[model samples]
Target: MGWFYSIDIIEGWLPATIWALVAIAMVVLLVAQRKSLKRAGLQIGIGLLSGALGLLATWLVSNVFVVFGVSLGWPVIFAVAAGFALLGFAISAAVMTHTWRRVVAIVLIPLALLATTMRVNAIYGEYQTVGSLFDYSPYPHISTLNLSLNTISVKDWNEQVKVKSRNTSNIPKSGKLVHVDIPNTASGFQAREALVWLPPAAFAKHPPRLPVMVMLAGQPGSPTRFFTASDTVKILAEFANKHHGLAPIVVSPDQNTEATRNSLCANTTKWGNAETYLTQDVPDWITENLPVSTQADEWTIGGFSQGGTCSTQLAPNHPNIYGNVLAVDGEIAPTDGSVDHMVKEYFNGSKSAYERQVPRNAIVNNAPSHQLMILGAGERDAESVSNIKKIGDTAEKNGWTVFRFTVKNWGHDWHAVNAVFKVALPYLCERMGLGNANVDFPTDSKIRELA
Candidate 1:
């Protein structure tokens, strides 16, 4: 199913609608062909059995790829699913004597329809069209500040400007989201172009240097995934609109160079220096180019899943770079989901060396810094929620300010990720010198607020 979505053709409502129509048409045809009760019942049973076989074949193939760490692209997955469907239909037809072809149609048609329906349901109202899935947030309509590159250095700008409170009555407009290629000079790594979301507050004539948030996406994910998957931009935009357009300058940099490769956000001898690329090159690029605040306390490192795990290590390990962290569904320790594989591939057969880079070990051995962090997971995601709790507890025990929360009835997906932002962004806003504008958001017992 994951691989099936990679194909752009089946992405929108059209395919889903067509599949549903085909399913309905097949059912009608099947009923017309087999009017007798005994034959109709047999046909329906055969059709359902074939559909089940098709579904099982699809699942088995997809899971086989996953278990072997071989992810098939959309085209391959599509072909595989089609082949299995055909095989299932043929088998069902070969067995049945009367109305066998109709049975085949009943099986394959409904199977395709159900797959499309589930996909549609997952992202129905989330986006308008399939194309909108990749579309960026609405750009700021209002005119922005004309600050030149030579106007002032980041250091001078931070020292001279006072963090002014935003006007509550007047709503500031949204900011432009620009895609900039940040060169990885520090780590000498090849990284994807970073996306920068400049809030409306950054556009004043004497623009206040907004705080910086370095956000990351999960493994097999891109930087823009944060925008497309979760309503991070929308949530932040709402907060900004209420608070006179005051929001942090969010820079989403790619953690993994490729979809399949998991860098583990480490400067290992195995893969590229992803840790350095993120902690150093990313910040250096932002400071040199963008008009953002450079204070460590004003800086935040955040991500979901693999990126979240990376944030935990990046903040605690490199306190001078990022003073705060947001880890959503983060692993307790950094691994490639396999300890032995991680040790062999990245750590060069050194378990102790690998353990040294883990967040718990790093935060424990080093003297506690005044860094603040939020660790969250979905309530339904028991294992992850439990792990995140341990990570948060460890941080709190080490004298770090940590807030832990759980998104009720959600699991480790974009919905859960959005929930984290909805609840926790207010806390982030207050920390970044943007006063909470009393934005009304959903609060329930599912959100387990930890001290």
Candidate 2:
């Protein structure tokens, strides 16, 4: 009967009445032959083994059909049920031959029933739709400005450590690491750090200026954070080495300040004008010390989390300077009014002025030309996933090119963002005319596929 159902059910799957009848018959047969089956331990074991093999075969067959783009329907469903049922009956029969077999069966039966019930409940639960996970009722307060910068600096808070440059003796070394220093700007202050991985071939022959990718760190730290995180440095170095000798010179600048918990990479009275520092002052510092290409397409900007938001904001506003923007789980909205107020305070009590600076409004009204937008979020990260979708939708509606992905079963964390860099970096390279349109998968491939 199980074999018959397993094949025929693929097309005209049996009705509920037939299922009930079959179940009743199976129960009756098991009870009626209980005394005779009691001595058949070998038979029970064989039945269980055969049932498990059958279940695995059914699963494999279904997978094969799916791979070829076909549907197996209820044959697959009945096969699973019959397989488990056979296993349970076999195990029960084998245990019942022992002295405390009844006690074992009593416990095992309930457990099996409970597991089945939970699986059924979970399947049904998936159908119930829910509201947006990101919706916060009492929205967080946004601070546009602040009255004081009196917060005590942690004495033990040394700046992030730096990575020593590798000897690229195989290639020509054209330039060296110049001094790292801070520059006083109109808004607060700015720190400029540069790395010149010049191939020796450049200096020996014709000295050619190289492309540059200005990397930004998200909130809660400085550009030095990337250095402290050795993985990021290695990734950037590998990216630079690839595309011939056209690897970008990376600029890591400090944009941290006292008035803000972390700079959103915007010009603000609260955070002392980060936008000016990054866009204006840092670029000037780079051009002065380093042999960097002045072409906008030669420059790319990318970051994770808050830094991603900053890159998105800065790239579009200064379209002539940045050609690539990669944002991972960036907060776009003003929350309640904290961001607005923060901007307003920076601009001397002009709350309405904050509207122009938000990334949502900016992109919708004026999408940048020669822009490469990459956004990534995890399926498990409900809020970030929704926000990333919204960003993608906006980009699509505005006729902007965007590479977006939601990794399965990941959460709002760096691990997910790092996984996304495999796709993001190549996309960035393609946009900058540095590489062909081939997507690169990460070596570790940390993300899992969802069932």
Candidate 3:
């Protein structure tokens, strides 16, 4: 069963074969329903008409009135229209006289639905392997982390960052990812389990204090997605292996109470105080538990999509705590929909209270000195590219060192998330005093200007 569930759903011969089978079934059912040329014409006509209507509806919803908030693009729109046409084909065939024809039509329904889902996923690049679809993770999960005796005290922290050791004899072959429950002591914000990534260096007998990167997953996502969806652990390990096992400790903490819920990453009446959770509870727990650096310059907050917005919000809002920021495809501002009712929401009704929470406004207001922020999105994700540039422009104007990046051959999906992070990992490691990666990220120029 595990092997059966391990099939790759994103790209492979299996998905192609399924789509081919569905197409063959649709044609078979179409031909079997033909009582005569006249009857066959009627059936085909209805299916085509239904498909046209579906396509029109999708276009209107995606473009005209702005349903789903973002455009579904041509691929998704076509897949959705094909779904409607598949239903039309099934319904038309079900009215046939033969029981065999009806049974065939019935079988086509689920197959077509699966095909549509696969098509959309292929376009958006969301779910990769079949195991990811089932929420299967490949990391260790424990009740609690016992690091008190394993770690040195804050007072004993070395002035030099981790990876100072030239010897690699004691370093583990691979890093460790442990899922555990972080005590919500300060904010009392209800959140799911958090994930911690310890570099191979941390496993050594005399591990030096390492830098910290606090990661937040996007909405409709969880902490494990930071591992399963993106390539953080893999890229970090590669960097560590090259630089004598030096990598920043990455911690994934949940801000939202549920998977789909949006807490706006702000304190409010309707949703929990997610801002307080990240700023106070999360940091305090890390300071007490992890054997990592305590300086603000050694700490970074980063995320994707909604999580990215949270990073921008939290880092700028509390520069004294997080001196670095990495916002990948983050929103221009925290919003539920088109209109952001600042005066009537949270403080009055919504979670994102005022302009102060916005990255564009916050960057200038705080005026972080020599802070480095990286803004990135997929090359095809126009919305994110635009939003990040808007925010990055403000950061540049305010004297913040900003780097813009675009993930190639992907858009608004996990592939883009992984690509962006892979590039950023080397740069981030060097920033944390790890051995140089020889990465030149086109500082003082646009992302397109990168060689």
Candidate 4:
């Protein structure tokens, strides 16, 4: 099913613009009540404090429930937060008697409402906007190879990768985005459709084998989340158009099988065998079903948020499969909640097992050498930026070639994902030998400026 909505007109920019206008009106109202400064000031401070307390209470409650494996989805969480805002407004309004103070309370109520709407939009509005614009016309499945999973030998696969990597022409007009069900015959992964973004090269009459990027989405999100919000297909398309359709075959697999089930990308009895589903089943399906390069260097394991954490975890643990890793706003470890919660729920109450599953712990223990790693986050996403920088430094010290980047003026949102991809795709092109080695691209220009 298409997760995209066609209400961009109402839900995307319109509401956000209105909220900004409301904020401006609130400022004007505050200025109008400037004559009664002392009274207005006291009421405004109290109202703001109350609102903050309410939000803090909601966060505290949310964290408490997370330990019990109960996920209060964003909408419900926001509703609870809104309740607190109302309570704050009510309490503050009751104590104020002056006309200007009453007017300030009236303006603040709508201001709080507008802020809530703005927050919701910032978090999720991109999905609706892009989902609405996307062309989800079903494309016929295309597979250039007809081999069984295990039949292809190392010698032939290596030769094929070499041949396909050299071709620069014979590209199609555009690629296709299709829903695929990577059979979870053994792992019993929750039923969810994966998204395959086949580049124009994959659609040519005699399709050249492309490299593969097994991507994962954040928890409480689907594969379509990346497709709709980040414009990943568009990013790949631009890269392909520039380099004669040489782009990675990006497959965003379904990580959070159930709506509330955050498997933490592990092989756990409680959450299903997510690790097997991702590392083994995904690669097996790609190798057997698609005409994609199987050379380790040509392959990438990447994702945003939890998926990014999963990439760091999976790639290091299974270095023979994925040679390159791109993690955008990745967590430092694999976790359902706190370490204690992760241990209790998925690790059979074993702290050691929980520690072993964390990406940093696993990487430190395994110590894979010469791996290409990109650790990216938004400048505004302070925690993630800090985590990735620390992790990247550690990885580099351990003999890995790590590139750390931060997108300016973005937080932990879809725009950050797009920004990272902008730099990452070109870097991949150079690494995979898809484009001219000497010719610098605009991504290089951006990188220089960032540097």
The worst-scoring run of ten residues by lDDT in candidate 1 lies at 68-77
The positional error of residue 70 in candidate 2, measured at the CA in angstroms, is 41
The model with the greater lDDT, 1 or 2, is 1
Best by TM-score: 3
Location of the lowest summed lDDT over 10 successive residues in candidate 3: 152-161
RMSD of each: 7.0, 18.3, 3.8, 7.2
In the range 245-289, model 4's lDDT, one tens digit per residue, is: 567888888877864577888887677888888888888888877
What is the C-alpha lDDT profile of model 2 across 1-451, one tens digit per residue? 3243232211133333334444553454456457777545454555576667766666566455443122222334345555466555646554544544444444444444444433332221211111111111121211221112221111111111012122122344232222255465544564434323332222212223555667655555445443332144455456655643334556666655531356556666665677788788777766665545677876877665566667767777787787666676666643324654665566566655566566767676576454666777655555666676776667656655676777664444444556666556665655554456675533332233321
Q: So what's the TM-score on candidate 4?
A: 0.73
lDDT tens digits, residue span 111-170, model 3: 878888888887776666787786676667643433432554322333223544443364
Candidate 1 has an lDDT of 0.67
Candidate 4 deviant stretches above 4 angstroms: 1-4, 9-13, 20-115, 123-171, 439-451
TM-score of each: 0.76, 0.53, 0.87, 0.73
Which residue pairs show backbone clashes in model 3? 345-349, 345-350, 346-349, 346-350
RMSD (Cα, Å) of candidate 4?
A: 7.2
Clashes of 1: 0
